[model samples]
Target chain A: QQPVQSPQAVILREGEDAVINCSSSKALYSVHWYRQKHGEAPVFLMILLKGGEQKGHEKISASFNEKKQQSSLYLTASQLSYSGTYFCGTEYNNNDMRFGAGTRLTVKP
Target chain B: EAGVVQSPRYKIIEKKQPVAFWCNPISGHNTLYWYLQNLGQGPELLIRYENEEAVDDSQLPKDRFSAERLKGVDSTLKIQPAELGDSAVYLCASSPGGRWGNEQFFGPGTRLTVL
Candidate 1:
C-alpha cells in the first residue's frame, strides 16, 4: 500500500527549516527519498534501511524509524533549489518500493 | 555513465489509440522499473524487472497494459487502447540490482496525453 505523507504542501523562505514525514501502515524494511521539480523526474536522494539511522544529502537529511514504519525528511537551511515535490518510497519484504502521495515544498525568495 | 533514458518525451493520442513508451536504463543496472505518476501524486510502480526476468507485475492493470524488457537492458511499456484517464507521466528507473541501500535513478519520463 502507498504510504501517507503529512503537510501535503509547505511554503518556506530560503534558510528556513522544514520537515516532511512519511508513514506506512505496514512494516517498512527500507525507505527511499527523492525530489522532483516541475515536469522532471524524481531524483534519488537517499535510502534508509530497517535500522533507524539518519542520512544526509547536502543540506537535505532524512531519518527512518522502522518501529513506527515512518520516515522523515529534514530540509535544513532550505535553498531556492530545494523547491520541489518530495516523495518517500517505502520498501517491504525487500521487494518493490511503494511511494507516498508526496509533500510539495516551495522555497520562495 | 548515463542515467536512465526514455523516449518520445511527450506523446499525444486520442482515446482508443495505442501508444508505446520506451526506456533504456543505465548500463550494467540489472533492476528496471516502470512507474506512472498522476498529477500531484508520487510515482506508482507498474512493473519491475531483474535482468531479463519480470519479477514483479502484480500492480499492472493487465487488461490494456503490457510491458516487456528484452535482453535485460531496454524496456517497453505499451497501452493497447488508451483512455483519457491514462493521461499522466510514465517514469522509468533503474538501480544496481539490490543491496541494502541501492537508490533508484530515474529517467526524464514520458508525458502521455489522451484526448
Candidate 2:
C-alpha cells in the first residue's frame, strides 16, 4: 500500500523551517525522498535505511524510524528554490516501492 | 557520468492514437523503473526491470501499455489507443543494485497530452 504524507500543502517565508512526514502501515525497509519542481521530474534528495539512519544533504535532512514504519523530512532555512512538491517513497521486503501523495511546499521571499 | 535521458519532452495526441517514450538509464545501473505521474501527484510505478528482464510490472495497464528494456541499457514504453486518462508525465528512473539504500536517478520525463 502507498504511504501517507501529512500537511498536504504548506507555505513558508524565507529562512523558515518546515517538516513533512510519511507513514506506512506495512514494515518499511527504506524511505526515499524526492523533490519535484513545476513541470519537471522528481529529484532525489535522500534515502533513509533501516536501523534509524539519518542522512543529510545541504539544509535537507531525514530520519527513518524502523519501529514506527515512518519517516520525516526537515527543511531548514528554506529558500525560494526549495519551493516544490516533496514525495516519500517506501520500500518493503518485496522491492515494491510506493510513494506518498506528496506535500506541496511554497516558499515565498 | 550523465543522468537518465528521455526524449520528446512534450507530446500532444488525439485519443485512440499511439504514443511512445524512450529512456536511457545511467551506465551500469541494473534496476530501471517506469512511473506515471499526474498533475500535483507523486509518481506511481508502472514497471521495473532488472537488466533485460522485467521483474515487476503488476501496476502496468497491459491492455494498453507495454514496455521493453532490450539489452538492459535502453528502454521504451508504449501506449496504444491512448485515452485521455493516460495524459500524464512518464518518468524513468534507474539505480544500482545490491544496496539496501541506493538512490534512483530520474529523467526529466515525457509529458503526454491526449485530447
Candidate 3:
C-alpha cells in the first residue's frame, strides 16, 4: 500500500523551515525521499533504512522510526531552491515498494 | 554518468487510441521501474524489472497495459485503448541493484494527454 503524507501543501518564506511526514500501515524497511521541480523528473534526496538510519543532504535531513513505520523530512532554513513537490517512498522488503501522494512546498523569497 | 533517458517528452492521443513510452536507464543499472504520475500527485508504480524479468507488476493494469525491458537496459510501456483518465506523466526510474532502498535516478518522463 502507498504511504500517507501530511500537509497536502505548505508555503514558507526564505530562511524558514518545514516538516513533511510520511507514514505507512505496513512494516517499513526503508524510506526514500525525492523532490521534483516543475516540469522535471523526481530527484533522489535521501534514503533511510531500518535501525533509525538517516541519510540525505546537510540542510535537508530525515528520520526513520522503524517502530512506527514512519519517516519525517526536515528542511531547515528553506531556500528558494527547495521549493518543489516532495515525495516519500516506502519499501516493505526488496519487492514491495510504493510512494505517498506528496507534499507541495513553496519557499517564497 | 549520463542520467536516465526517455523519448518523446510529450504525446497527445484521442481516447481509445494506443500510446507507448520508452525509457533507457543508466548503464549497468540492474533495476528499472515505470510509474504513472497524475497532475498534483506522486508517481504510482506501474511495473518493475529486475533485468529483463518483470518482478512487480501488480499495480499495472495488465488487461490493457504491457511493458518490456528487452536486453535488460531499455524499457517500454504500452497502453491499448487508452482512456481520458490515462492522461498523465509516465516516469521511468532505475537503480544500481538490489541494495535495500537504494536511491533511484529518473528520466524526464513522457507526458501523455488523452483527449
Q: How good is chain A of candidate 2, measured by TM-score? A: 0.94
Tens-digit per-residue lDDT, A31-91, candidate 2: 9999998987788898888876645476678878888998999999999999999999999
Residue pairs whose backbone atoms clash in candidate 3: none
Error in Å for residue A39 of model 3: 1.1
Note the DockQ of each predicted structure.
Answer: 0.85, 0.76, 0.79
lDDT of 1 by residue, B1-115 (tens): 7888899999999999999999999998988999999999999999999898999999898999999998999999999899999999999999886464358889999999999
lDDT of 3 by residue, B32-78 (tens): 99999999999999999999999999999998999999999899999
Considering every candidate listed, which one attains the maximal DockQ?
A: 1
TM-score of 3: 0.96
DockQ of 3: 0.79
* lDDT per model vs. reference: 0.90, 0.91, 0.91
Error of 3 at B38 (Å): 0.2
Which candidate model has the greater DockQ, 1 or 3? 1
Worst 10 residues of 1 chain A by lDDT: A51-60
True contacts kept of each: 0.91, 0.82, 0.79
